[model samples]
Target: MIQHFFLLLSIQFRSFFGAVANEWENNRLKLIAGAVTLLVMAGAFFFMFRGLFRYLASLDADLFGFGTALASRLFGMALLAFGVFVGVSSLITGNSALYRSERSTLLMAMPVRRSSLAASSVLQSWFNAGWTMLLMGYPILIAFAEGLEFTTVYLSRGLLLYPLLLLVWLSAGTLLTVLLGWAGGPSGWKLFGGIALIAGCGAVVFFAGGTSSDLIIQEAPGMQLGGLQNFVSDLPGQSRGYWPHSLFLQAMVKGNGNAALILTVEAVVLAAAALTAASWKFLEAWNRSAVAEVRYRSPMFFKDGGRYSTVFQKDLLMFMRDPVQWSQLGLLTGMFAIYVINLGRFPMDFTNPYWLAVGVFINISFSAFAVATMMVRFAFPAPSMEAPGLHVLIQLPRGRELFYGSKWSQTLFLSVIPASILAWFSTMSIGAGPLLQVESVGCIFITAFTLSTINISTGCLFMRKEAGSAVSISSGQGGIISAFASVGFVLFMVGVLSWVTKKYMTDNFTELMLAKPVRDSILYLMLPVGFTVSIASFRAGIKNLRERVF
Candidate 1:
């Protein structure tokens, strides 16, 4: 059984590497562009972390009097965040790699042990989910070493421990998918997942709300170091619950050989246990999942009978049928809800118009980034996802235009509503004046409009008909370009608006206090910028579609 599993894994690895080599050979420009984008992002993060650590090191208290303890706490929090992300990725990828994919079905029919198949699937999911983080992790470690002036020993220890920690997370996540599949099947798993996520978010809000009121009252006089100290103190204990991560921090940063040995033992044991459980019951779970059916009813309101109504309905159906899309969106919404809830709880002196304006600008800035993320994740893949129906689409009258328009319209419409809502609520919670509130909402609208155009255009320009998933396409070279473009634009707008608002608020403090407009403006001079960007993106998309489709 072990031999078979190793052979299968070897084949999978070879296939992956071969495909990567082919991509490099065939699309060197695109590959180089993507690599450069990733490098730039990593460099930015590296410098950011370096600056932060430099400041922390300079502090007499050594990071608010916590010393290495505080460093450990921060590292622990980072690990905790990464663990959650890896676990979610593993579960989603595991379900597909193990049970749902056509390749899995083919593998099941072969003359091999079910245990080997399950083992291979688990490892494949782990590789797919964890490899991307290597680039992210390396920069952080390098930054930590340089910033803190750590020796090679510390850096080496960290480099060794990170992948081990990732393995532990992968094992736990894979085991979860195995158990969920065995107990409730795939549909049951997704239902439970959605409910559990919603419940978890609710619990967080409840607890945050219960605790924040007193903290706000206590700190209302002024923000103090003590409250922050107490909060930081709590994190070490709270983070200890994630034993692997805590153990990793101890082993890597503190040079605890015993902790390192223990972590290694735990990782190996947990992996073996996961494999054993999969060998015993994963086959049964796989069989159960193979036969399960998911029935979803499409919305009744999609009955408009225009020339492109069918395209719209088809796109809606595609989106609705894909559980991954909606589930991730739900998670994003829950996280955003928590963010807003916490924002409202902050002890902001709303009477101070300057601070109020700052708060509103911050909210709008965050909302703009959120909108850009939505565009990259969901909107950028709209055109490529139509590959399965491309033949039919091409046969329709003015089909390319209809196809692109449907996707563009759908993306813009879906994007603007949420952007506007988030802006309004966030501003209202901060007690911004009516004029500023209107301005904030309008800024978000322009952000949405501009970003949607950029994403749809770039997506069409970089359409990959043979891609297996929306995620694969969205994480491609073109998606990186789209992301950078979106972020660069948002940063520019934020900078401009921040300067304008600060100037206006300073000049017309009394008048603004009376809830009056400070300046007659062409959107603080952002409208022309936005319009120019939108026109350029639209033209690029049209040119690409004409060349590709016609």
Candidate 2:
């Protein structure tokens, strides 16, 4: 059974690598862009850790010692949270896909026991959970210990601790999936569970953030470390029940000490036990319940409804019906909210219009990127969603161009217009003057056009297949590529606008300030050209789609 489990895991790993490699081959430029992105992210992490460590090192010896312990604890908490996030998202997405694949159909028919099949599946999930954790964690670990010697203690502790963290995350995810799978039906339960998990994680982050702040304050001059040391000492006793994070922290601070070793062993043992039990019980239920097909029947239509209007309504209804579409929009909205909140926190001198203009431009850029990304992910997948039904549509009196035009029109109405309104509102709220306001409006229009074109192009390029379940991050590289390209385009445009604004300010600040109409007029000129180019791109994409089989 163990051998079979290992064999299955090996096959899964190879399959994953092959999928990634194929994506890299198809989108080599985008893959390279992603690598560059990872590098930039790594650099940012390194600098952040360097600054943090430097600050810690500069403290008084007593304070440094206490802060180190606190930092370790907070880091452990972060690791646990990251693990949970990766584990939950992976387990849910993977289980949904696996349930659809019904791979158990083949495995169940084998000479092997059901328990072994379940174990193998669980192990596959663990690999996924572990890989996702490592992607973010390894960079952090490297950054945290920058300029430090490679001691055996550091290596051994990390090796032991990370596995425990992975186990904690995987076990928790497995247990949650099992419990949720048992619930059955698309009740409000899934939404409630998602909200609860997010809220719980947010609360943990807030507490950890506060604790970190306190630790920093304690490192200030003339502050005694006694209280801090006492707090650290009490934490271990109080957190005895929360062994995963505690044990990981202990291992980090004390390395391979007997206490740390014992905690590590306990965590691993508990994870294994929980996983075994969850797999044995959950697999049977999952196989049976997961295959139940859901049929959504539309309400009866009114006889007087116009065909064009009906098409639009159908597109809107379908968009709302898909949870993934709503989720993407929700994420973008959440990001925009965060951006606005952070911008409000900035203490800017309103007397300097340049500062306000810069703020508005930054906010607009963020909104544009968010809008473009959401459009590509949600709108581009529309054609694929048509599936076998597309043949029926193609056989209709109208050309495919008309069908494509209707879809694009729907995207413009539902995605583009809302995004533009939000961007303009955000800019105006940031106190942009009439000239800046006009420029902002033009920017929003251009952004909407660019996003629409990119989304349509992506739709034409990538043929969507029904993987029989919810989308996973690892499913395709097309969305990632489109997202990256959208962000890059936004950055490029924003950079040019910033440069033009700066040059205008430097060359004739007073004149430009006084001649608001002239400056606004120049900005508005960009709109027509942008719209023309975007429309042309959309048409080109349609032409490409006609040539392709999909």
Candidate 3:
């Protein structure tokens, strides 16, 4: 069994490397785009972390001289957050690999042990989820080391312990996925459980916010080590009963070797336990999943509607059919809620127009980046996601209208509406002027519409059947190009807004509110640019679809 597992693992590794080699040989552009995207992301993460560490290290004036302690706490919170994220990702990817894939079926029919199959799947899931975490994480650690002047030994220890942390998370997630499959859990129950989990997290964060905010609000010396720990713990780690973050912090940053050893042991034990149990129960889980009834039915939302309406309903139903999509959307929503609530909690004066402008800028920047990323993840693969049914779709009369219109409708509901609402609430939370609030929401709508057109256009132009899933499709060359292009547009928009605001808006809220002429000028510049880009992108994408796809 061990040998077979090793062979399976080797095969997985070869498959990954071989795919990379094939892309490098046949589609070098994809390899280059991916490399450029990775470097840009790494650089961004490094700078962001460096800035955060510097701020935490300089928290003496306001945070009561607990700079170092707060920095350590921040480190722990980052690790815990990443761990949880990877775990959730693992559950989604692992479940699919273990039961939903045809390759798994072929493997199960062979003479190999089911244990080997399960073990291989677990390892595969770890690699899939862990690589991103590693790429994003190491840069932060590097920045932390540089910002805090930590020894190289400390950085090395952190690098070593990070994979151990990922192992624990990946194993736990895989175990949960397998356990659910073995228990023959209904899809409804799984959905409900995820909802309950997210809700419970919100409740904990809500309760913790009061206590943590009080420490800062009072301007007491208690806002030192204990207070900082409370803030970090309540937000990420302790909220989920996760302590490895503390262990990693103590071991790596504080030079506590015992904590490091303990974490290592925990990772090993959890991983071994997960592998043994999953392998032992693999047959039963396979049987359970295989025997599960297919209960899907035609969605009746637009059963009797027109062709465009039917396409819209089909897109909506496809999104709803995937539990992973709902879970991810729920997670994004939860994060945004936390972010808006935190904006309200930020210890900054809102009455001053300067501070208000700064807040608005930050809010808009965050929202724009998020919108761009979500577009890449969810919108960039809309056309490719239809690859399996391309033949049927192309045969329809007025197919171009049906396809593009359906995508536009999906973007309106899924991306534009949500982004507009988020912008409205976030700007309101920061107490921006009424005009500024309206402008912010309008900007978000324009941004969302533009990004959706760009990404959906790229999806059509670069539709690939072999990608097989939205996740895979979104990692392609077109997706990378779309992501970068969308982000660059957002940066340009923000720059224009900032320049206009600084050049025209006055220091007082009333003066800024009365600056209608300046606001109108800014809108005139932005609106035309946004519409031009959207129109151009739509035309290009439609041309590609008509020539190649249709």
Candidate 4:
């Protein structure tokens, strides 16, 4: 029986990778393009951070041990932030693995033990989400470990501590899902959960907004550390139950063996506890998720959200009705609110026209990127969202257009509008003249429109057959390609816009060697460039669908 259970778990993993391998084999070109783009982006991010770290280290201020303490503090925050990111992401993947997977129903029908399925599902979620944490976090980590020698203690971090910590965190998410299921979860609880979440987010935004940004930076009080004595004095103080972050830093950054041992024991204890709980409760959760009528229905419980709107409106309803979808969106919105709450923290002198110009430029660029990021998640997987319903869609005339158009419209409403509002405020930050702010809004809109169009096209081209949460999809081949390609495109456009802003958006370019008419013409050329590319990409994608997809 034990052998059979292990075999079943192995099969689950094989099947998951098999699906991905098959997709990659069939679409080698697309996968290769995505891989290349991803590598490029990773390299770019690494170099960018490496440069920042070096700059900070080279700073004139020797306070806080010449930025070593500051680096440590920032790394500590990264670990905490990433731990939360991993937990939330793993939760999404866990939900998909347990309740949304196609294999779940089939495997449950077999005479397999629930523990086997739960074990396999937990591993699957770990791979799905935990890998992203490693991929994104490691570059920053290695960059910061610049001056440290390759000692045994430090090498342990690379080989042991990080992976163990990630696994423990991933298990926590799976364990939470099991407990939620055990408690007769969903239904009205989902609605209440959603409301509570929004309220909490609002409160955070309010608190942050009311707090001055300078106060935030000032309150973190740093010790002036220049040498060994300074280092000891500035070291994170020990507290009861924990040394605040000294243990974590010692284990992760300093590679202290004792700290490493502590983290190892903590990870082992956490993972063991979580897996044990999940193993016991999973079957119950599985039964409740589908078999129990109340668990199956959403909070409103009265109406089928699908019945109201048959096309575009239907997609909107679907997005709103599902808490899983909202979870991803809310996470992003909450993060954005963090910036909104502290807008005053940015040091922009409205009296200085160039500074105002730079401020607006930075804000609009960030807003555009944020909007694009949202599209790559929600819009890219839209094609797969049709899933087993493909037969139903294929039977209808012009179904692909309707579906894609609906997704595009929904993305615009949800993504573009919010991005524009933020860009408007960002423009307002520098007290920009009405004309410049309006122009900045137009530029942001163009960026959003171009990126969204490409996302829909890319999503349709690489749609998968499986059902997974947006996070899982975003982690998949299609999603990766869409995101990387979108980033590449955004970077190119931003670079161009940066030049245009410098030349035309500010006072005079003609006096600086380039004529105003020439700069104006160049900027005007970008308008058609974006519009033409968007139309061409959309048309090509639609044609591809007709030729192959139909």
Candidate 5:
């Protein structure tokens, strides 16, 4: 049985890695080039973070008696954030692994023990969440670890416990999945997304607001020896229910060998115990889930949306039903809200043309970059999203242009309209001139209009019907190409914006040097270019899909 489990896990790992490299099969040269590009990007970020941490280490926190405790606090806070992210990722993915997969039903009817089922599910979640957590944790950990000379115990605990910590989150998340199923029934566990979203938004708002306090505390002068303890204790009391996290901090900051040894033991024992407990209930929980009875749901806080055209309504409903998409969009909206709210609050010197121009420019470009990023996620997947329904649509409608138009209108309603409002608010948030405000909105509108059409058109051109699952679809080569194209287009816009700003700046601070009308003219010129590209792309794509599908 154990051998069988291990074999299954090995296959699962292969599938996951193969999915990541799914684009590599076609062209050897392209694969090599991609590998190089990814490595370069990773290396650039890693070294950049390392340099920042080294600088932070050099900063004299002597004012606050931060001498030794500063490292401990940093270690604690960073690990806590990382662990929360891992846990949520595990919870979301694990829920899908347990509930959404038909394999659960198949396995349930077999002779498989609940223990085996739970163990396999937990391991799969760990595998899914592990690489991401490691990649994110490593640069921060490695940078900090450099300063703390690695003793044998520190090396053992640090290397072992960080991964152990991730395992703990996976195990706990799996257990939560079981409980949610038990309480809510089959699809009941998905309610976790709602809870997670609320918590995440509150966290963003708090995090955004707390930066001022951190800055103040760091700068405040109070360098007596006792103040160090006071400073550390001043933080809100942490529950420390998660021992791996606590031990990680202890090992890093206090250099406690006992804590490290105990942590290693606890991690191994607790991992087994949690999985066993979860397995104890897994069969019963899954049986209840398989029944598919309708459990009562609480009243929704918001009313449903109004009806649009049939095609648009269908796409809108489809997008709303997917928890994965909603969660991502919710996070984006929350972060954007935090940014916009803080933009008005963060004081900028209007008297200094350099600061004023640069601040407003960054704020405007930030809005553009943000909308494009959101579109890549929401819009670019348009074609792949239709794979399951493509045959049905072809048999019924046979109107390719109508279908594409519906998507275009839905994209405007979903992505473009909201984004334009946000961009205008962001521009006004920083007190830009009336002309600048209008220009900012037009630029975003052009970006949204072009990107939306581009995504659907390019998506149709490269759509992969064989990639049945959302994860596999996004990993497909077509999706990758679409994303790269969107990014490149965004960069072109940012570059143009930067050049115009620079040109205007170098003209002796004369407001007339770059006249409002001229600036408007240059931006207006972009609309025609965007219009030409969108027409060509949209036409070719609809033509191809119509011929191929209908």
Candidate 6:
């Protein structure tokens, strides 16, 4: 049994490594970019922790007597919350690669006992949890105890208990995954679960912070430390009595021999029991409930042979039927709502050029993100979505042109309209001169044109062998390409706008600076040039698509 567990772990590790390595090989530049980002994160973490430790060391033991307890509790909750958040996201996302794979299926069919398989899966999950905890939580724990003069017993307990907290997280995640998988149709339920999970997490943070604040108010009245120190010192207890996190923290702080022994035993027992139950029931339940089917039907044909309206309507229907398409749009809607609320909070004087520029930039950022996401998830996948039907499409009369036109029309309608609306709202709210407003709108259209063109061109050029699952983050390289293209386009647009604005100011400094009409006129002239270039890019993309053999 032990050998079997180890074998399974080895296989899973190899599989994970291979998948990641392949992704890197195919998209080396993106992978390098991701690595650089991770490096920056590590550097930031190190500096943050070092500063925290130095600050803690400078405090007097008498004045900072309460600091130890406060820090421990805050660290514990952070660990707990991080664990829970990851667990919840995994559950909603469906650990198909880990849990619903051929290897797992074959292993289940073997003579291997359920206990061994469960143990192995639980261990894998725990390792994942630990990596996550180390990345985000360990710094806080290490910094909190730095220069505090803790005993070896306390240090040992802290070390031991960190993994145990991670195990608790793994247990929670495994249990939730099993339950959600058993429920079936993860796509339908995941949205609901994800929203609920995010909302629940926000509520937990709010209440926990509020409770801690109340506690500090009651206990340490009128204490006036600096803002950062005060925030750290006044945090709530890590957990209530007997809570897993609290027990772990207690072992770390007090380090009583008996307490350590009891917590260790309790953690092991709980983890073992959960794993056993999940293993015994999960596979059977999943097998029974995993198969979810979606049905699609073509629309009824009209008497006039449907004509142009028929083809457009068919494409529209197909778009509506796709869960991925709708989901992307739904996410965009949520993002837009958030952006509007944030915009309302900006302290902007409508007449100020600085405010106007800021508002225009924000709108551009929002539109760019939205359009990029749409293009990658929808436009780039357009060819693959047609699948075997693509052969029939090529054979139809003027099939190539119709095919390209339909996709282009869909992309335009989907990307341009909402982006224009957002740009208009931003410009009007900022009270920019008419010319500047027109220029802003033109900038948005230019951005959309460039992004949409890149999306289609890439979709035609780099066709995937299979229709990748929508939920997987690293499923397609096209998304990374889209992201890169969008960023590049935005930067280019910013440069051009800046140059044009600077040139106008240089030519007519006093009038451009003080007169709205002059500023508006300059912007209006720039708009047409920007619009023309964007249209040229769109045509170039279409030509590229026509030339490609795909």
Which parts of model 6 are misplaced by more than 4 Å?
A: 14-95, 98-108, 112-177, 189-196, 199-280, 291-325, 347-357, 429-436, 471-475, 498-550
Q: Rank the candidates by TM-score, best first.
A: 1, 3, 4, 5, 2, 6
Model 6 C-alpha lDDT versus the unseen true structure: 0.58
TM-score of each: 0.85, 0.68, 0.85, 0.76, 0.71, 0.60
Which regions of candidate 2 are displaced past 4 Å? 1-4, 7-88, 109-111, 126-171, 185-192, 203-208, 211-274, 291-295, 300-308, 316-321, 324-328, 331-358, 428-441, 465-475, 500-529, 532-536
Which 10-residue window in model 3 sums to the lowest lDDT?
Answer: 209-218
lDDT of each: 0.72, 0.58, 0.74, 0.63, 0.63, 0.58
Name the 10 consecutive residues with the lowest summed lDDT in model 5.
208-217
Model 3, range 246-356, lDDT digits (tens) per residue? 677667776778888988998999899887877887887878877876467875677689887877777777877876666677667777778877786666666657667
lDDT of 2 at 436: 63
Q: What is candidate 2's CA lDDT for residue 305?
A: 81
- The TM-score between candidate 3 and the true structure equals 0.85
Which scores higher on TM-score, 3 or 5?
A: 3
Per-residue alpha-carbon lDDT of model 6 for 1-550, expressed as tens digits?
Answer: 6787787778778988998899788978867876675565566565676565445445435444454444454565565566565554344333453355555578777887665776676666556445645565555566556635442226656776776665655555556666555566344545346435543553464345423342232235665444334445434344444545666666776665565666677667767765666567666655654465556667675435634565677777876665445654665566565565456445454354544555665565666666666667667777556644666776778676777677777787778877777777766665656666666677777677667767665665555546554433223455555556666666666766666565445654332453453344335643554456556655755675567565
Best by lDDT: 3
| Model 4 residue 380 lDDT score | 83
For candidate 2, list the clashing residue pairs, or say none.
none
**What's each prediction's clash count?**
0, 0, 0, 2, 0, 1
Candidate 5: misplaced stretches above 4 Å?
1-86, 130-175, 185-277, 292-308, 347-355, 395-398, 466-472, 503-514, 517-525, 532-536, 543-550
